[model samples]
Target: MASEILAQLQAQKLLIVNPRRKNGLIIYKKYYAEFAGPGAIVGGQFDCDAIAVLPVGKISLIVPQTPEERRQAYKMRRQWVKLTKQITDNPIPAERAQVILNQFEHWFDAQTVENLPDEAFALLVGVLPQTITKVRNNGLF
Candidate 1:
């Protein structure tokens, strides 16, 4: 029975959420044990800058599988791509941009625009696409 459970776990594929950018949700196809370590934050750390890992079941709960959700997801992914381009255009190094992306991911999960730290909010607002401004300003994201 234990081995059967372990086998099931090994076959599981988790969804990783990088809330700040496009292509934020990725499938984690590797063994779950690979992420069992000291630094493991939500299933185990991957090469992604800042990602939240969860089972597909859990992700489905948080992100409904609906037309509206699909629209929002696609929009966020496009914004993420734009954000990456902006980062490339600026003097900020790729390493630093990754850090910034991670910060945004945390902010997305933890705080609303209204409650977010001013500096962080300002930095994002300055670089983010205009399409995102409405949601950001309304404190909805």
Candidate 2:
């Protein structure tokens, strides 16, 4: 399997920077190698995790993205955003919560989130107040 992957990589003039030391590779191939797929000899088929045949040029990779890798990354990102929202919105009084939400939205619009330091994030999390219950005084209540 290693040899086959190596051969395909070499054929496509693709570079595998920093090859993995263990747990074999996840190869991404074109859906129809007959046309857009590699025009090279292929070895016998074998399965380890999942088998995928994507359209040619569908993936450009320094390292192929495994199913688990993609899922874990998305999950972590979702959790991060959820934590940030919970810290900023759920606990603070309505006025203060809106202020924080606006600030966060501004940070996002200004493209500053990427540059924010760990200290800034930690401060935000640390200062979040306990959630305040809102009781409606109107007839709807």
Candidate 3:
């Protein structure tokens, strides 16, 4: 689902930042081990699933200074609904829209500091040419 969204975003020329890596064992030990047990260890990584489509003649920049600065940068980019709406409004079919929405929802669901599954991170990096092909065939976008 996320791969589908990424493909659509890229097609619309949106900029996507790489997601953050997760230290799976470290995170599990530090957080969930108390309830799930050591045997329930899981791991994953994440990228900022946020997409930013710069306004015409405008450029988007990412400057990673301190960790706090990086967080702020991501937050600002994530909250830019203008960019998202532009991409979403690109004449895509309803099915395509739903796929993108699902992916975005999944990313939103993983916004917490812990307990995010590895699959979420995997989705962060996955690509979906199939979605693009479908859109192209349907002449939706």
- List, in order, the clash count of every candidate structure: 1, 2, 4
Please, what are the lDDT tens digits per residue for candidate 1 over residues 50-140?
A: 2222221112212334656545544544555465445446553333334444545553443332343333322332333332343444433
Better of 1 and 2 by lDDT: 1
> In candidate 3, what are the lDDT values of residues 10-64, reduced to their tens digit?
4432222322421111111211111111111111122222242111111122224
Clashing pairs in 2: 31-54, 33-37
Deviation in Å, model 3, residue 47 alpha carbon: 4.5
Choose the strongest candidate by lDDT: 1
**Could you tell me every candidate's TM-score relative to the true structure?**
0.29, 0.23, 0.24
Higher TM-score: candidate 1 or 3?
Answer: 1
After superposition, the stretches of candidate 1 with alpha carbons farther than 4 Å from their true spots are: 1-63, 91-141
Best by TM-score: 1
